[model samples]
Target: MDVRTDEIAEQIYRVSVFVPHAGGGAGFTFNHFLIAGDEPLLFHCGLRKMFPIVSGAIRAIMPTDRIRWLSFGHFEADECGSMNDWLAAAPHAEIMHGVMGCRISIADMADRAPRSLANGEVVDIGGKRIRYIDTPHVPHGWDAGVIYEEVTKTLFCGDLFARLGDGPALTESDIVEPAMIAEDFFNLTSLGPTTAPNIRGLAALKPKTLAIMHGSSFSGDAEGAIHSLADHFEARLRMALR
Candidate 1:
């Protein structure tokens, strides 16, 4: 299983690993985002089994030990499976997440003490400023949250735009429809009343690039894509209610 790396934005690198027969043979991609800076930040750590290759890919761009900040959307294996591995490798690295996540799981789960951020809290990691936004159960998981890089206007989409298949590293095309297909296939979202509203709030951020966790990363009309995705979920919720 080889991992591919691409610069989705200025200093933001997308590290992707494709599993040709995942999700009941529908195919899938797991992507991690690394923002290069004085205090380098890595978004997702992939699964624990993916540590070696994922770390190797990260090593190509910078020393694995140089990673100062570790973060993810939630406490899932795919999101922070390599949490301890990263902490062991990078002595200075510390896990960062929303207050609720830390209080609920990360505090006990992480080998090292983790830092919790209040909603809208910004951390300046040298060249980039990352703001943590609480998105509990937006897509799924009560510990769910996301990050936005103020410098590049890039939104780190956890499983929000998740899709099946190995697509390009980045695209300017419409991704909302493909995401909807995956949603139908997996039924991955929580589908609560707040799901669409939580997503619509993110649309207000006006992100320039979307660093998706699965499938392809998207550029161009990110806000439009986000709103469209939200509308789809809203419709789904209404149908379910009816």
Candidate 2:
């Protein structure tokens, strides 16, 4: 089935941000929000190809001289591949990731220093709250996490439920509702069922929205989606035995 994409507005905390970028590239080119605060924040920086769009979107909100906070759910080009580029562009931008991510990026992968985040480690950016929850093995990387913004009800989900040909906008319902996002989610797990257990890990938050770095963000009944996903995994496992 062909799923059409939509790029609608999701107004949060008096901020104007782009939805997600139209897909014609390797990964999801997200709008990447520039949250207003004493020190502003930038969500997932789209793929290297999508950097221009990210730069432009960020430029709209932050001045060229302002320091920015660069963060991602996990380490990937789409999530943070262009880390060096963003660092060069925004010298004031501080690269923040959790311990595993810090280890992988600084010690093993990119080898750049970063501020490590642990579970429940909250960073008050100006006045907004950014809480990190450890999500291991969901994307199968040593360092992985999902960030929750208490101020916006948004969860900066990494690869929890990504899909193909996604729009540049955010929100599960705005483009594709939870039911369909759930379906696409299962499809992804079909390719990587090993991450099944980690899905349950995200359930504790009971997020109102599952803000995946790719595809659509599940906006309603996040725990329900997790349950449904768990059920789907069980069904798949059962069918495989038959």
Candidate 3:
């Protein structure tokens, strides 16, 4: 397992762990983002077993104890498996997630109470402000939601554009094809009626940077890429229903 860090966006760092042949012959990458701001935030905790690696990567930028916010798109092991570990490391850190995630899981699973954000709710972390967007069942989690950093126009979009292997830390290249390939193998999308609409809502943001969890973060024409994904999923759903 090789863990490395890169600054994918302004003040946003990506900590990626690459595991070769981990997913039954296909290699995989798990990513966590650290946003350095007034209240430093870490999005996605990686797996519990990888806490030392993730935490060490974080400590390289700032003291793990200085992390004020720990957040995720949904309640999953890769997303929040080290929730308690983080809470213990960062004494002042508080969990943040969508309202449903709070009610359904974080509230009970976290050692401390999580600050639940409703759709469109914004939390200011010094110079940067993050707005939460509810995206339930879009990527297969009922409590799923993504955050937009107002300053950088970066969307911390969890698994929306996930691809396989260890790709570039940040790329302006087209990721739609790779993402589609991963979708075929993982079938991570929900295919629900609301999925398309939810994706369209994210596209409306016109984000410049997409901070993904499972693979490389994407840059450039993020809105277009999102719409392309939405169209693909919508077509698949229509065909399946037919």
Q: Which candidate is the best by lDDT?
A: 1
Residue 139 displacement (Å), model 1: 0.6
Instruction: Give the alpha-carbon lDDT of every model.
Output: 0.94, 0.60, 0.91
Regions more than 4 Å wrong, model 3: none
lDDT of 1 by residue, 28-96 (tens): 999999999899999998899999999999999999999999999998999999999999999999999
TM-score against native, each model = 0.99, 0.73, 0.98
The order of the candidates by lDDT, greatest first, is 1, 3, 2
The TM-score leader among the candidates is: 1
What lDDT tens digits, residue by residue, belong to model 3 across residues 1-242?
A: 88989999889999999989875567889999999999999999778999999999899999999999999989999989999999999999999898999999999999999998999999999988989988999698899999999999999989988888878899988888888899988888999789888998888888999998878899989999999989998999999999
Per-residue C-alpha lDDT of model 2 across residues 1-242, encoded as one tens digit per residue? 12222322233221122334333332332434455667776667546765665565556655744746777777776677666677778777777778888876644544245778877798888766888887665544657777777766666667655554544344544332433454453443332455556666667767676666555555677777776665565566676777
35 Cα displacement, candidate 3 (Å): 0.5
Worst 10 residues of 3 by lDDT: 19-28
Candidate 1: clashing pairs of residues: none
The better-scoring model by TM-score among 2 and 3 is 3
Query: For candidate 1, which ten residues in a row score worst on lDDT?
Result: 19-28
Question: What is the Å distance of residue 16 in model 3 from its true position?
Answer: 0.5
